[model samples]
Target: MSFSPAAAHPRYDALLAEWCDLLRRCQEPGADGAPAPDPEPYGRDLLGRWGESQRKYHTLDHLQAVLDRATELTAYAADPDTVALAAWFHDAVYRPDRSENEERSAHLAERALPEAGVGAGRTAEVARLVRLTVTHDPAGDDHDGEVLCDADLAVLAGDPAAYAAYAAAVRAEYGFVPDDAFRTGRAAVLRQLLDLPALFRTPYGKEQWERTARRNLTTELELLTA
Candidate 1:
């Protein structure tokens, strides 16, 4: 079902307002004299997508959390607005059973951002940031991408109760898969994260989240393997 404002997320209104302001700032006057596109419809569409029935973890709350973290790390971002926009659309096309969710979400950003008046260069940057979430491995020089990726992963460093809830929500999202298969797949993903040279790319992220994230991932991996 589509998201209705009244029944939708608690943060939906604030997020919509924030997007509207961001899009308005990014809008360029049309060459043909067409009015600048409205951000309200675009924001509403994204909220509806995030509010879809199948999404248990990739909801507005997750988006808000990422945006909050991105805001906190704005000093490290080349383009803070682009990072925030990327966070908005990174999981916009989520499908728990699909491996191409990040790619599809990036494509969605490419298609929709221009219509919302985001410039071509900035839109491409946003799409690149969204795609980077697939591996959470931004290029060494990509400051904005690193911030966005780290923000998206900040939940891994949350306190134990919050981390447990995050895990539960993820499991709920993949409820279509059998428990045995889900556990196996999840453990593999955790192991891969643990095997990474660094769980977070930015100095801020490394200092603030790396150790806690590794601890949480190791603990969860053990449970999954057990």
Candidate 2:
């Protein structure tokens, strides 16, 4: 399929146009624009620099998955602009070697938004929300962040069959690992997910993601143990 902003998200067609215009203006040299970088190039560069496993984890498909969920939860979001920005930049810079990939991604967003005329304060808030994806902790005041994180993780809570396919895809991305080590690590990760109080924290996420997530976790865990 062609990568049309209209095709992937009909609802955001207008918003996509607006965003593109904004990006293009920013791209213009010395046109009173603050010289903002093209986010698409940033996305491309990040993916291009990634190792195999990180590439799969931070793939365009994963971004699309999170963006889809973020769109669904946007109706209930009070500050959807912040949520959407967080969704776009949350995984902007992913480095598997470091535990601070979220922090770095947030930093990139912080730097990029101000140049694009998004106020510094609002940019910081969005960056905070992007960082919050790492913790995936739900708080009364952080409903939007929770929803975004849940959406980011929805693949884990998706249908068992699909989740199994995702797991295999992930394993393939990490094909360097031995079969026994991969099975052990994968099972451990699934168990950790099963141990969480709830797969999705926000009301919307809980309603939409809990069952499938649990099913996926359980199936994987059983397969690992057996």
Candidate 3:
């Protein structure tokens, strides 16, 4: 995606520090204990990707929100740092018109994480978690997946105004689509999410967000159809 000056996030420094800290925890020293590569460049690249112009909803602000939510949900994740990393790469390759953005983002994680000195297993887990964003239907026992998915979806539980703004921003991202088509696709998405047995897997998420998110999705779906 192309760079967008206006989409730049205000908390770049804080976000970078967050990324660097997470990366440092995951890094494995080189042969003979050589230090891992600096995490700043990788954090900068990810920040740039999140700020890409074609995005409206998937901006750096969204990234920071997800990161914060993921951190909040770490109590449910078996590997909190890995969940943090997954949060960083989850939408790193977002494109409104592209269906394979999740896979590509996962691939990007697969390639980048190991080079950043993360262990192979953690890198693979990170990529798997990124791909899971496609369905956001993590199995019951998938702790990390549950946290990542819940964090990614926490925006749905926002108050009416924030939720409305989120809907508008999403519409703006797919501006290339005709109004009718966008409504149809967006309605289907809401229905799919609504059809799930449970929207949020973690105990805190279920108690805090599930009902609100369902209400929001139902309202959005009704509006889209109306």
Candidate 4:
């Protein structure tokens, strides 16, 4: 809830605090006035998944960044808290080698949220937003989708050094692929992103992030092709 939550992650107390805040916003108060259900267990479970040994780019640090970005863009969302829920579950089932991570992550949210006190509509919304990450292309009027998509992709607009680190981390994640194959695949992905009319849909993202992200993606693409 605070501005300093930028560093709030699984290893720190702030992440747990942040999750509880999100839970409170989406879940109705317990029968009468009792406190909302505890959200820490689910948060902890997801944190453990993020901290898995195979991860390099899709780690707890990435989750923290997405959550932080979603917080920054909260004003653009029709339901900011619901977007945050999506952030937590977006990579909950990440496995660099897997093709269905998004679907699996969405399923995890669908099964877990209702039991965690989130209403059906919000639960489905969270799952839908998680699935959206597969493309990161939200419709023009989809404010909540825009927020979550932009937040997940904000890393692309980072400073050169940060972008370099992100690129390196990604290569590390797909280490199993042969060098030539990885380069070709990576270049294609970059080209697809470059082909988009705009890499970011949110106004702030379009204005503040678009140019830099395009530059970064182009640079990466060239490197891969070269």
| lDDT for each residue of candidate 1 in 1-226, tens digit (9 for 90 to 100) | 5437423577778888998998888777887988999899998888888888888888888988999999989889988888888998999998888899999999999999888777899999888889899888878998998899899999999999999999999999999899999999999999888888888888888999999999999999999888
lDDT of 2 by residue, 33-122 (tens): 555555454443333333223565566566667777887887767776677667777887875446698899888888877765566667
Candidate 1: worst 10 consecutive residues by lDDT?
1-10
* CA lDDT scores, all candidates in order: 0.88, 0.68, 0.92, 0.88
lDDT of 2 at 36: 55
Residues 101-129, candidate 4: write the lDDT tens digits.
Answer: 99999999999898888889999999999
The candidate 3 region of ten consecutive residues with least summed lDDT is 1-10
Q: Which stretches of candidate 1 lie over 4 Å from their true place?
A: 1-7
**Cα error of candidate 1 at position 192, Å:** 1.1
- What is the lDDT for 123 in model 3? 95
Ranking by TM-score: 3, 1, 4, 2
Q: Judged by lDDT, which candidate is best? A: 3
Clashing pairs in 4: none
Q: Write down the TM-score of every candidate.
A: 0.96, 0.75, 0.96, 0.92
Q: Judge candidate 4 at residue 56 and give its lDDT.
A: 91
